[model samples]
Target: MGLMALVTLGEWAAKVGRAETAVRNHLAAAPGFPAPKGTRPRTGKGTPYEEYDEAELDEFLKAWEAAHAPARYQVPGDPDEMRTLGAIAKLLGVDGKSVTQYRAAIDEHAAHEDRGARRYYRTGDVVEVLNSRKGFGVALDPTRDRRRTATASEPGS
Candidate 1:
């Protein structure tokens, strides 16, 4: 009679492994059936399913990690030091133009601070840009530098 009723039928068909085309046809033919709220039925543009095995998924994850491993170097402590597009470009081993594009991607609220002077990027943010990944990476805090340096300098002192 309504969208919820249609969605319930779709969910049941999905659980029973019915062909997506059949489910769509059924939904389309039903009178008073509203479109599902959050999901859109596939429009037959691309492959519907890849059907990867568990080992394939695991291998995909491993390849992703290997491709995104961070360079073995500590980032500079000052956020401002790393703020400039040129500086970020050098740090990430990319062109200045790429850095300019990255500046565009920065969250707008974070971008507008100190009259646009204090541009700070967490370590994780740099990693995300460099890795071209969706998630943030670990950020370097200036306050912790002293403790890090101290531990490095003392050979069991």
Candidate 2:
């Protein structure tokens, strides 16, 4: 029989630029993909090793490249301006209403609110708010936290 090489999930994941878990998931879903031959190190309990001859590895590499190739058609122009509220909303994976509410909250609490028909916010600010408020939906306002802490510590709070 021809010689077969064995590779671990870690090696495959590294070659494909994916996490080990993702490699396991893909292997599970693709029955046609090469199956694990045996445990690694060939002595004690270890992760299952997938059998790969030179031809199989080349086939896998070609398939991976084709799957990840960028789309042929590209957008006509540069994407929408980053400072626009709509663009910010898209980047943050939120709707216009959420962006508006965040802007309003910042304006109300801020020392000076910009006055214009089309108010613009820095992309950095929107990203910061989105990342900071991901779980609790509360802006990372140190002053607000201090006030709550002081109030709770008071005798009648």
TM per candidate comes to 0.32, 0.38
Model 1 RMSD, rounded to 1 decimal: 20.3
The candidate 1 region of ten consecutive residues with least summed lDDT is 148-157
Error of 1 at 109 (Å): 6.6
Give all candidates' CA lDDT scores.
Answer: 0.41, 0.47
lDDT of 1 by residue, 31-138 (tens): 433333343334456433222232333344345445545444345455434365556667767677755654655543233333375555554455455455232121
lDDT of 2 by residue, 1-157 (tens): 7776655655554454444455456543554565556653433454434444434654765665456443232222333223656656665556777666556554443233244766555555445444334222112453353322222211112
Q: Cα lDDT for residue 68, model 2?
A: 48
Which segments of model 2 are wrong by more than 4 Å?
1-3, 41-51, 68-73, 77-157
